[model samples]
Target: MIKVLFFAKYRELLGLGQMTVELHSTTTVADLKNRLVKEGGDHWAQALLADNTLCAVNQTIAHDGDAIADGDEVAFYPPVTGG
Candidate 1:
Protein backbone atom coordinates (compact mmCIF):
# COMPACT_ATOMS: atom_id res chain seq x y z
CA MET A 1 0.00 0.00 0.00
CA ILE A 2 1.08 3.59 -0.63
CA LYS A 3 0.61 6.15 2.08
CA VAL A 4 -0.94 9.40 0.87
CA LEU A 5 -0.91 12.63 2.83
CA PHE A 6 -2.67 15.93 2.24
CA PHE A 7 -1.39 19.10 3.80
CA ALA A 8 -2.42 22.73 4.28
CA LYS A 9 -5.60 23.66 2.51
CA TYR A 10 -5.76 20.36 0.73
CA ARG A 11 -6.36 18.55 4.00
CA GLU A 12 -9.16 20.89 4.88
CA LEU A 13 -10.70 20.73 1.43
CA LEU A 14 -10.53 16.97 1.23
CA GLY A 15 -11.45 16.47 4.85
CA LEU A 16 -8.61 14.00 5.19
CA GLY A 17 -5.05 14.29 6.37
CA GLN A 18 -3.89 10.89 5.24
CA MET A 19 -4.92 7.65 3.63
CA THR A 20 -3.55 4.35 2.41
CA VAL A 21 -3.99 3.31 -1.19
CA GLU A 22 -3.42 0.05 -2.96
CA LEU A 23 -1.93 0.60 -6.37
CA HIS A 24 -0.29 -1.37 -9.14
CA SER A 25 3.48 -1.61 -9.30
CA THR A 26 3.55 0.53 -12.43
CA THR A 27 1.59 3.35 -10.95
CA THR A 28 2.96 6.87 -11.20
CA VAL A 29 2.09 10.06 -9.39
CA ALA A 30 -0.29 10.96 -12.20
CA ASP A 31 -2.00 7.64 -11.87
CA LEU A 32 -2.44 8.15 -8.17
CA LYS A 33 -3.91 11.57 -8.73
CA ASN A 34 -6.29 10.14 -11.29
CA ARG A 35 -7.35 7.45 -8.89
CA LEU A 36 -7.94 10.01 -6.19
CA VAL A 37 -10.04 12.05 -8.59
CA LYS A 38 -12.08 9.00 -9.44
CA GLU A 39 -12.61 8.01 -5.85
CA GLY A 40 -13.12 11.44 -4.33
CA GLY A 41 -14.90 13.01 -7.30
CA ASP A 42 -15.49 16.76 -7.24
CA HIS A 43 -13.87 17.32 -3.91
CA TRP A 44 -10.69 15.71 -5.12
CA ALA A 45 -10.77 17.77 -8.28
CA GLN A 46 -11.21 20.93 -6.33
CA ALA A 47 -8.31 20.18 -4.04
CA LEU A 48 -5.94 18.61 -6.57
CA LEU A 49 -6.82 19.47 -10.14
CA ALA A 50 -8.02 22.98 -9.67
CA ASP A 51 -4.65 24.53 -9.01
CA ASN A 52 -0.92 24.03 -9.30
CA THR A 53 -0.69 21.67 -6.38
CA LEU A 54 2.71 20.48 -5.30
CA CYS A 55 3.65 16.89 -4.52
CA ALA A 56 6.39 15.14 -2.64
CA VAL A 57 7.46 11.53 -2.62
CA ASN A 58 9.04 10.45 0.62
CA GLN A 59 9.57 14.10 1.54
CA THR A 60 11.23 15.02 -1.75
CA ILE A 61 9.49 17.03 -4.39
CA ALA A 62 8.19 14.89 -7.23
CA HIS A 63 6.51 15.39 -10.55
CA ASP A 64 3.45 13.77 -12.03
CA GLY A 65 5.48 11.22 -13.99
CA ASP A 66 7.49 10.10 -11.01
CA ALA A 67 7.22 6.45 -10.13
CA ILE A 68 5.55 5.29 -6.98
CA ALA A 69 6.11 2.09 -5.11
CA ASP A 70 4.55 0.13 -2.30
CA GLY A 71 5.24 1.55 1.17
CA ASP A 72 6.07 4.96 -0.34
CA GLU A 73 4.75 8.10 1.28
CA VAL A 74 3.32 10.77 -1.03
CA ALA A 75 2.23 14.18 0.12
CA PHE A 76 0.29 16.95 -1.60
CA TYR A 77 -0.06 20.61 -0.78
CA PRO A 78 -0.54 23.99 -2.30
CA PRO A 79 2.43 26.18 -3.18
CA VAL A 80 3.87 28.07 -0.24
CA THR A 81 3.97 31.84 0.01
CA GLY A 82 5.39 34.28 2.51
CA GLY A 83 5.27 37.99 3.26
Candidate 2:
Protein backbone atom coordinates (compact mmCIF):
# COMPACT_ATOMS: atom_id res chain seq x y z
CA MET A 1 0.00 0.00 0.00
CA ILE A 2 1.11 3.58 -0.67
CA LYS A 3 0.37 6.30 1.82
CA VAL A 4 -1.34 9.39 0.40
CA LEU A 5 -1.48 12.69 2.26
CA PHE A 6 -3.77 15.64 1.71
CA PHE A 7 -2.87 19.09 2.97
CA ALA A 8 -4.60 22.44 3.34
CA LYS A 9 -7.39 22.84 0.81
CA TYR A 10 -7.02 19.29 -0.31
CA ARG A 11 -7.78 18.05 3.19
CA GLU A 12 -10.88 20.19 3.12
CA LEU A 13 -11.85 18.91 -0.28
CA LEU A 14 -11.23 15.23 0.42
CA GLY A 15 -12.17 15.40 4.11
CA LEU A 16 -9.17 13.32 5.11
CA GLY A 17 -5.57 14.05 5.85
CA GLN A 18 -4.24 10.70 4.84
CA MET A 19 -5.18 7.39 3.32
CA THR A 20 -3.51 4.16 2.24
CA VAL A 21 -4.12 2.88 -1.23
CA GLU A 22 -3.22 -0.50 -2.64
CA LEU A 23 -1.18 -0.31 -5.81
CA HIS A 24 -2.39 -2.81 -8.37
CA SER A 25 0.80 -2.69 -10.45
CA THR A 26 3.46 -0.24 -11.59
CA THR A 27 1.82 3.18 -11.44
CA THR A 28 2.71 6.82 -11.85
CA VAL A 29 1.53 9.83 -9.89
CA ALA A 30 -0.91 10.76 -12.64
CA ASP A 31 -2.20 7.19 -12.71
CA LEU A 32 -2.88 7.34 -8.97
CA LYS A 33 -4.69 10.67 -9.33
CA ASN A 34 -6.83 9.18 -12.04
CA ARG A 35 -7.68 6.19 -9.88
CA LEU A 36 -8.61 8.35 -6.93
CA VAL A 37 -10.81 10.53 -9.13
CA LYS A 38 -12.38 7.47 -10.68
CA GLU A 39 -13.20 6.04 -7.27
CA GLY A 40 -13.97 9.19 -5.29
CA GLY A 41 -15.88 11.10 -7.98
CA ASP A 42 -16.26 14.86 -8.58
CA HIS A 43 -14.82 16.37 -5.43
CA TRP A 44 -11.75 14.22 -5.61
CA ALA A 45 -11.35 15.09 -9.25
CA GLN A 46 -11.50 18.80 -8.44
CA ALA A 47 -8.97 18.56 -5.66
CA LEU A 48 -6.45 16.40 -7.43
CA LEU A 49 -6.65 17.81 -10.91
CA ALA A 50 -6.71 21.48 -10.07
CA ASP A 51 -4.23 23.66 -11.91
CA ASN A 52 -0.83 23.94 -10.23
CA THR A 53 -1.65 21.39 -7.55
CA LEU A 54 1.67 20.32 -6.11
CA CYS A 55 2.75 16.77 -5.42
CA ALA A 56 5.61 15.18 -3.59
CA VAL A 57 6.87 11.68 -3.20
CA ASN A 58 8.79 10.75 -0.08
CA GLN A 59 8.96 14.46 0.71
CA THR A 60 10.56 15.46 -2.57
CA ILE A 61 8.77 17.22 -5.39
CA ALA A 62 7.24 14.76 -7.83
CA HIS A 63 5.92 14.99 -11.37
CA ASP A 64 2.92 13.34 -12.92
CA GLY A 65 5.14 10.81 -14.71
CA ASP A 66 7.09 9.90 -11.61
CA ALA A 67 6.56 6.28 -10.69
CA ILE A 68 4.98 5.41 -7.38
CA ALA A 69 6.00 2.30 -5.50
CA ASP A 70 4.50 0.35 -2.65
CA GLY A 71 5.20 1.97 0.72
CA ASP A 72 5.91 5.39 -0.79
CA GLU A 73 4.55 8.49 0.87
CA VAL A 74 2.80 10.87 -1.48
CA ALA A 75 1.43 14.29 -0.63
CA PHE A 76 -0.76 16.75 -2.52
CA TYR A 77 -1.38 20.39 -1.76
CA PRO A 78 -2.03 23.73 -3.36
CA PRO A 79 0.78 25.98 -4.47
CA VAL A 80 1.86 28.44 -1.80
CA THR A 81 1.87 32.18 -2.25
CA GLY A 82 3.36 35.01 -0.20
CA GLY A 83 4.38 38.58 -0.71
Candidate 3:
Protein backbone atom coordinates (compact mmCIF):
# COMPACT_ATOMS: atom_id res chain seq x y z
CA MET A 1 0.00 0.00 0.00
CA ILE A 2 1.00 3.60 -0.56
CA LYS A 3 0.49 5.70 2.54
CA VAL A 4 -0.93 9.07 1.52
CA LEU A 5 -0.88 12.06 3.83
CA PHE A 6 -2.46 15.52 3.76
CA PHE A 7 -0.98 18.45 5.62
CA ALA A 8 -1.74 22.01 6.60
CA LYS A 9 -4.48 23.54 4.53
CA TYR A 10 -4.91 20.37 2.57
CA ARG A 11 -5.57 18.37 5.69
CA GLU A 12 -8.27 20.77 6.69
CA LEU A 13 -9.68 20.76 3.20
CA LEU A 14 -9.74 17.03 2.83
CA GLY A 15 -10.90 16.39 6.39
CA LEU A 16 -8.35 13.61 6.93
CA GLY A 17 -4.67 13.52 7.57
CA GLN A 18 -3.82 10.22 5.99
CA MET A 19 -5.08 7.28 4.03
CA THR A 20 -3.73 4.25 2.16
CA VAL A 21 -4.05 3.32 -1.46
CA GLU A 22 -3.48 -0.02 -3.12
CA LEU A 23 -0.01 -0.40 -4.49
CA HIS A 24 0.33 -0.80 -8.21
CA SER A 25 3.69 -0.92 -9.94
CA THR A 26 2.70 1.49 -12.67
CA THR A 27 1.25 4.08 -10.36
CA THR A 28 2.79 7.53 -10.24
CA VAL A 29 2.07 10.40 -7.88
CA ALA A 30 -0.27 11.97 -10.41
CA ASP A 31 -2.14 8.73 -10.89
CA LEU A 32 -2.67 8.32 -7.18
CA LYS A 33 -3.88 11.92 -6.97
CA ASN A 34 -6.32 11.43 -9.77
CA ARG A 35 -7.63 8.32 -8.10
CA LEU A 36 -8.18 10.23 -4.89
CA VAL A 37 -9.99 12.97 -6.76
CA LYS A 38 -12.28 10.40 -8.30
CA GLU A 39 -13.02 8.72 -5.00
CA GLY A 40 -13.22 11.84 -2.86
CA GLY A 41 -15.37 13.62 -5.41
CA ASP A 42 -15.56 17.41 -6.08
CA HIS A 43 -14.18 18.66 -2.81
CA TRP A 44 -10.98 16.72 -3.19
CA ALA A 45 -10.55 17.80 -6.75
CA GLN A 46 -10.42 21.45 -5.70
CA ALA A 47 -7.79 20.93 -3.03
CA LEU A 48 -5.57 18.40 -4.77
CA LEU A 49 -5.81 19.70 -8.29
CA ALA A 50 -4.99 23.28 -7.43
CA ASP A 51 -1.89 24.65 -9.14
CA ASN A 52 -0.19 25.58 -5.87
CA THR A 53 -0.59 22.15 -4.36
CA LEU A 54 2.65 20.28 -3.76
CA CYS A 55 3.56 16.66 -3.21
CA ALA A 56 6.33 14.71 -1.57
CA VAL A 57 7.31 11.09 -1.74
CA ASN A 58 8.95 9.44 1.23
CA GLN A 59 9.84 12.82 2.70
CA THR A 60 11.35 14.11 -0.52
CA ILE A 61 9.60 16.67 -2.71
CA ALA A 62 8.45 14.95 -5.85
CA HIS A 63 7.09 15.70 -9.28
CA ASP A 64 3.82 14.41 -10.59
CA GLY A 65 5.65 11.82 -12.66
CA ASP A 66 7.47 10.33 -9.68
CA ALA A 67 6.76 6.65 -9.34
CA ILE A 68 5.25 5.16 -6.21
CA ALA A 69 6.06 1.87 -4.55
CA ASP A 70 4.62 -0.32 -1.83
CA GLY A 71 5.04 1.13 1.66
CA ASP A 72 6.10 4.56 0.38
CA GLU A 73 4.57 7.59 2.04
CA VAL A 74 3.18 10.36 -0.13
CA ALA A 75 2.31 13.73 1.33
CA PHE A 76 0.32 16.60 -0.11
CA TYR A 77 0.23 20.19 1.09
CA PRO A 78 -0.31 23.69 -0.15
CA PRO A 79 2.64 25.94 -0.79
CA VAL A 80 3.71 27.89 2.25
CA THR A 81 4.38 31.60 2.43
CA GLY A 82 6.73 33.31 4.89
CA GLY A 83 6.85 36.88 5.87
* lDDT tens readout by residue for model 2, 4-74: 99999889988999999998887999999999999999999889999889999999999999999999999
Q: In model 3, where do residues sit more than 4 Å from their true spots?
A: none
Superposed Cα deviation of residue 81, candidate 1 (Å):
2.9
Please report the candidate that would top lDDT against the real structure: 2
**True lDDT of residue 49, candidate 3:** 93
Clashes of 3: 0
Q: Each prediction's Cα lDDT score?
A: 0.90, 0.94, 0.88
Task: Please estimate how well model 1 matches the true structure, expressed as its whole-model Cα lDDT.
Answer: 0.90
Clash pairs, candidate 1, are none
Ranking by TM-score: 2, 1, 3
Cα-based lDDT at residue 79, candidate 3: 93
lDDT by residue for model 1 (17-41), tens: 9999987676888888998999889
lDDT of 3 by residue, 1-83 (tens): 87899988889888899998887676888998899999889879988899988999999999889998899999998997768
lDDT of 1 at 6: 97
